[model samples]
Target: MMRMRRKVLCLDWDKRTVRLLVARVGSGRMTLEDAHAHRIPAEVNTDDPAALGGVIAAAMAAHRIRRRDVIVDVPRDKSVIARLPLPPTPIAELPDVVRFQAVKELPFPVEDAALDFVTLTADAERKTATEVLLAAVRKDVLGRIRETCAAAGLRPARIGLRPYANLVSVMHLPGMAERRVLFVDVGPALTEINVVHGGRLAFTRAANVSVPVLGDDDRWQSSRLVVVGGGGEQDAISGAIHDLVVEVVRSLQAYRATESNVVIDNVIVAGHTGVETELAQALEKRLALVTDLFDPTLPLGITGDRGAELRGFSAVLGLAWGLSTRGLLELDFLNPKRVVRRSETIIRRARLLGMAATAAAVGAAALTWSAYRAKAAELADVRKGMEDLRRVVRDARDLTNRSAEWDEWQYDAVWLDHLMILSRALPGPGREVIIRSLVCDSSSSSIRVDLIATNRERVKQFVDVLADLRAGGLPDEPQDSSRPKLYRVEQGSWVEGNTAEPGFSGSTQVMLRVVDVEEFHSPAAVNARKAERERFAREF
Candidate 1:
């Protein structure tokens, strides 16, 4: 048995910044491998697809990431989330029910929105109603995001809401699972309020709020008078924070008012902008609730500077953690058609490979039988010719000439040499390039290849490399009149609209003609090709 290792890349972005996190998930555990943060330009419109795409591309390049398994945390402002109670419905009919519910609940037309839902609680006996969290985003918004990520050479596996991500992050905190708690994540422009009861999210809301803009090194500090009570800019920011706390208090009261049996026992504050002792103390004093700075990474047994940055990455961490552990929340807005297309492509490839192998095996057996019959006939003729010395000598000369011509026609190393040339002509590590299919014509000595890449830049680079290879510019391939020639190049969309596979959306078609085989027949070239094949086989 072999253990499967899964690597997931999670991204969270807001108006100010985009954060990238990579984690290796296995055996019910997740390990954070890398983290990066890129600030958006003040002039760039975050809503513009082209602008955001460039930023995402630069961030991915800066982080040196090549993996495509990604989950993005969309801004809470762009999404609509609601908790709905519905009569017991069969699992198979839930999608239709959810879609119908979304049409009524969403502000926009159902056709213009992407909808998903998760059942939070259900009665086992199917006698009572079930509570479901329904999420919706406008199609235009989701389409723009999809296009932008595709341009950046990424196709996110899931698009998660920030509030749900935050809930997943703090739900496992000590005493949190057993008690009702309010998780307030204060961001730069918006504050997310999530209420967790019995380890499940009961309520969530996002309110516009402003907080102090502090740098990484700036510890939250205010003059004693300002901390106590003052009238200035710092005091104004404090006032804003206090107002946010008041909103949380109101939401808590409202939740308790409706559900009389539930009471929020604690308030947990977490986010990049407002995870300070001052804010927590203020909330505790004002709300008369036990308030704490929520750092969920502590429970994962992570420490040091990376763990310290967990406050800023609460949502992304939750996304990765939930994916690893298969948590209850599973909402993704990635187009279903695209997912189905990818699956179909994979299945098609597998079937094609199996068919090709079977055909090759059958052909080999037929060729062997034909060759044996030809050899038997030739032997009988040779024995007959042995009765006459002159006939035997004449037949032997004919046979020698025929064998020489056959040897010239069957250059065993031609295909191997062509493969080696292609391997050298393409981008290697750190480049998002995939050769989807390859075909060689023996009689014409031409190769046709289908390639897909992450972005246009990489595809252009591949073309340039092919041109160089054809010109024999590389060190290993010497210049000659009979060098390989580039015949045709075709570039097109690998995946159109939102139905494209991640990291494989840019498509290119290439044809190369191997004009000469004399070079590959040399002893040194044959030995080199043999050694390369051996090494490849060992690695495989």
Candidate 2:
């Protein structure tokens, strides 16, 4: 539990004193830092348009108090009130049911009644007990008070019945130490009596104080506290006190029989304008129970600079204590409209952001994984390509080395001498004038020779030489065909120029790629292309 400090303003219309108590309940001590109490003006006309509750307001201002919880006692002449029954239902659903019940129960109709309920307790069976206090004050009385409080800069957070408040406050004294206690508050005209047994309020009754008794006594300080409301002449006051004491003795006797579990040990009197010693002595004279004056800072457990000052201001202290509980009394003192709306908005925003963040994280993870896999695949492909290229380069290097070691000079002389030999092997040479350029394509294993010729008949001699070479077992095909067959030749147009001879201006080119061939030394055909080329060359 956290430390609790609150400024409470209290007014007893009977006593006509406005009391300010700033009390803090902490470390098992109630410290009263400041205390201010003031008497009301005799002829202030509290019922006037601007007169009601003015004295208490002035005390608040004197203390420079701007905000506080005020607990004010109603005068004796005021009879307007309401009480509601609460049970067989939950505490949270009380307001709706209160509205429904008050409509019929309140003779003035529910709308005219200002209703507020304080739930006393709820047993384990879901049976709730509530005290619904309805004030049926004159509209003018409320309007005047509202204007006065507003002008005084006092915001009345809770307006409660004086009798109920006194009862509740007296029950929470430092250490009264009684399972069953009696709380009696005497006002100017009416006296309120309450019995709190088993830590819950059992009864509340209001009676007229026909004879008032004023005393200064210290005996009323235990389970029972007498509250003598202040007013009247000396005779009037003395008579009121006697009448109150008699009634109090009868109540204790009746309670002991009805509730056999409880014991009445002591009587404590809380005076409005009276003393404790005189009141305590008078009570002991008539009743068998011991009597004492009420001192709320009792049991002497508290230690602080202001502990003594806060004892009398228990009503205001009770107001703060009431706030410390969760879901205690259902009062509209707290404006919950703004709180509920803000909470729902915050929760909705947080939920939306949480879902969006989850989805984004999942998507980013998937993309990152995909990129990693793609890079791995690309690296594998590059590695395979490099390995194949390395093999190719190694094979080419081996082939170059072998060629270099075997007959390098002879190979150069016969390097492309085969093309020249083929040209010379043509029958009836000198038809085609010369071979211009020969290109050997190793990729396709084909040889192509460009020829500049003088006559078309020289092409026929070239074709005959190719036929003879093919029959001698060189790879061959028919020389002339419509298609460009393998090992076949095609003649280009005559070279554009002077017609040295009819149709003898252009060159012819032969293109072939051979995969199989025959050796000329086999003698399958004499004067093979290879041999015939040597013979022609010899003649030239």
Tens digits of per-residue lDDT, candidate 2, 1-540, equal 112234455443443444555544333334444555455555666555356456656666666666545444343234254456655655556666666766766556555555555554455575554555443443454455456566555666655455445555555664553445566554445555566554444555566665333332322221123344444477766666677777777766766655577665555555454533554677778766666555554433344433434434544554444444443222332221112233344445555555654555555556677765665565555555555555654565555556544433332233243564465555444544566677875444456766656666676567555544431122233333432222344445555445444545766676644322212112453245446445544542
Instruction: Please report the TM-score between candidate 1 and the true structure.
Output: 0.57
lDDT per residue, candidate 1, 1-540, as tens digits?
Answer: 012447888888777667788888754567778776666776778778788878878878866888765788666678888877777866555667777777778888988888877777676676334667888888888887787788778887888777777777776566676777788877777888888776566788787877664542212221111112223367757877778878887877777776787766888887665335677888898888889887765666666344435666778877877777764446677642112223334445555555654555555555677765665565555444333444444455566557655655555434654576677767762357778788987655567877777766776776666655543234245555454543334444444323155755556677665544434455686587668555644543
Give, for candidate 2, the lowest lDDT window spanning 10 residues.
Answer: 332-341
TM-score of each: 0.57, 0.48
Best lDDT goes to which candidate?
1
Q: Candidate 1, overall lDDT?
A: 0.67
The root-mean-square deviation over C-alpha atoms between each candidate and the true structure, in angstroms, is 23.5, 48.2
Task: List the candidate 2 regions with Cα displacement exceeding 4 Å.
Answer: 1-12, 25-30, 52-54, 61-87, 120-145, 174-178, 210-234, 246-265, 299-314, 324-540
